[model samples]
Target chain A: MTGRGDGIRPRPDAAAAYGAMLAEQLRQGGLAEPRVRVVVADLLDHVRTTGEDPVQAFGQPADYARAWVRPLSRWRVLGRAVATAVGAVGMFAAVTAFFRGGSWSARMSVTIGDLVVLAVFALGAGVLPWTLELWLGHRAARRVGRRPRVPDVVIRAGVMLLVLGLLFTVFTAFDPEVWEPVVLGPPRPVVFVVGMVVAAVLSMVRQPRSPALPRLPGTPERWWERTPGRPGRRRR
Target chain B: MIVAVVVAREDRESQWLKGVLDLAVLAALVREGSAYGYGLLRSLAEAGLTGLKGGTLYPLLGRLEDDGLVRSEWVTGSSGPPRRYFFVTAAGRAELEAGRAGWGAFAARMSTALEG
Candidate 1:
């Protein structure tokens, strides 16, 4: 089984990719790397003996990683809760400031209608991208037959857009007269466009490169059966 | 249609395997005294429990270790890379015994029910 050309020679690249992925997961899960290395070595031995493609045999690297980091989900949930709370507070302050003509110490005398409009804009600006990302991630996981680990750059961009849009909205609400000069000012649009384009390019560059596998034809039942929350099986 | 049926059956089997897998791994370690991941998996397969994926097994081992039911150590092979050998702890052995007893009783009850 160990002989070269005996159809069982280990694929070094695949083993390396698997090792890197496992290591990242272990790190994320706060496991000791030395301990994980022992397991990785053993798994590599299995790969050598069977000559099976690791991804095909074990499922997507991200999904495999996630299985080990199930405990991290609680922290993720807690973090999201904290973020939403902080965002709400910030949105309230921003909206209030906007209503007071961008004056921080202005009187809290805005009408209920004004408050409602600000709340709507704030929610739309802050929550829409996040909801969209989650929905897209769920859809991709089901359709692609693998877990969708959204890239960090994409996440950062979404956050940046959320913040920028919120700022723009608050500025407009503060005083429509002053808003145009600050946000849609002569050089601001050009800067925003350039920043967005650069961010998109960087995100594309940072995405993991993998050999594209052919997509299989999906049956209606299978499509419906694939719930976003369900862990996927290793597709051969 | 045939493919769909086979896929569904595999899905069901995988879910069933997940439930019994911890028992199987613990039993394998207890029987073997100590074994590395791949070697242990091969032993299980030889005993007729094949198709266990690495993704499934490694995390389970990690969890078992975390739960203090198993312990692992790195030992260098004479000719190749170091391997993590896992051994069943005393707690693990006790757990395995309890699990076996429970499973035996459950199986007997199910057998009687089905026979009826």
Candidate 2:
């Protein structure tokens, strides 16, 4: 990946990049998308108009967002992490059931390889991205004099892809195709039912509360599904 | 060295604004009747709240609007993207007055204490 030197001028998209970064942080913090859009627009309007470097203006996007969005407690983060993990596992089981096409009582055709794949998929899809984002974003918020470079972002993304690719490649090389497929037999009803129930409960009960959107003009109140009488976490 | 100093100064200014920003913002809206974001920044800077970032101000405006203290709408600009202009609601004006009086008394007390 390469970076443009502002066409020998300077990186012109810094403000935009910062806005995108901040918007992502806010969304991850449970802010609604429309509210995020409005926030980003307001940020860009001022920065673009003034020709201000966003880092200089806001220190770090992540830091500013953390302060502005009200940091979630550690338990809340843990709950979200749990939800993502359980959801991924449940999804894998559902997909397996779909492909195998049998009654719920049928001994599921799951391999040790399938289990490996599921673990890798769960860690990759459910665990890694947001965990890294939260950790790195939190740390970066503390350091100043950071510059937004397209190449830097591209490289980080590429490294992440490489890691995931490497994991899949390793899992495939041991691809039970070469050996007697290690068979984990009979999907027991108790474990299966419990897993499904836990997943269902977590999915329903542990949803990251959608931050309430401030009543923006031209938008109707009927559109948002706030709980009856309890306004969602006041749009911090 | 120079950049560090500038950054440090800006940090100090922003820290000062941190506590009083929402109040200042509310006061600004009431005083101007209405203003867009950039216009608000300009007004605040002129009033000695320099080095305040858009990151700091915009979110507070949003929170204020969210809380029903101020309201905003997108208006077409002569150039560039449309701007969202904000106005203090009656509630917002009322909030500004109460906050203003409270802040004034606090500041006076601080000044007296500092002189001692």
TM-score of each: 0.52, 0.66
Write model 1 residue lDDT over A47-83, tens digit each, in one string.
Answer: 7655767776566655665665442354553444344
Give the lowest summed-lDDT range of ten residues in model 1 chain A.
Answer: A205-214
Q: Provide backbone clash counts, one per model.
A: 0, 1
Residues B40-80, model 1: lDDT tens digits? 77778877998777767877887788788999876665776
Model 2 over residues B1-83: C-alpha lDDT tens digits?
A: 99999999978976766778898888777667788876787778777776666667776777788789999989885777767
Could you tell me the lDDT of residue A81 within candidate 2? Answer: 74
DockQ for all models, in order?
0.27, 0.40
Among all candidates shown, the one with the greatest lDDT: 2
Question: Which portions of model 1 miss their true places by more than 4 Å?
Answer: A1-7, A25-45, A48-50, A70-236, B1-6
User: On a 0 to 1 TM-score scale, where does candidate 1 land against the true structure?
Assistant: 0.52
Query: Chain B TM-score of all predictions, in order?
Result: 0.89, 0.81
Please tell me the TM-score of chain B in candidate 2 relative to the true structure's chain B: 0.81
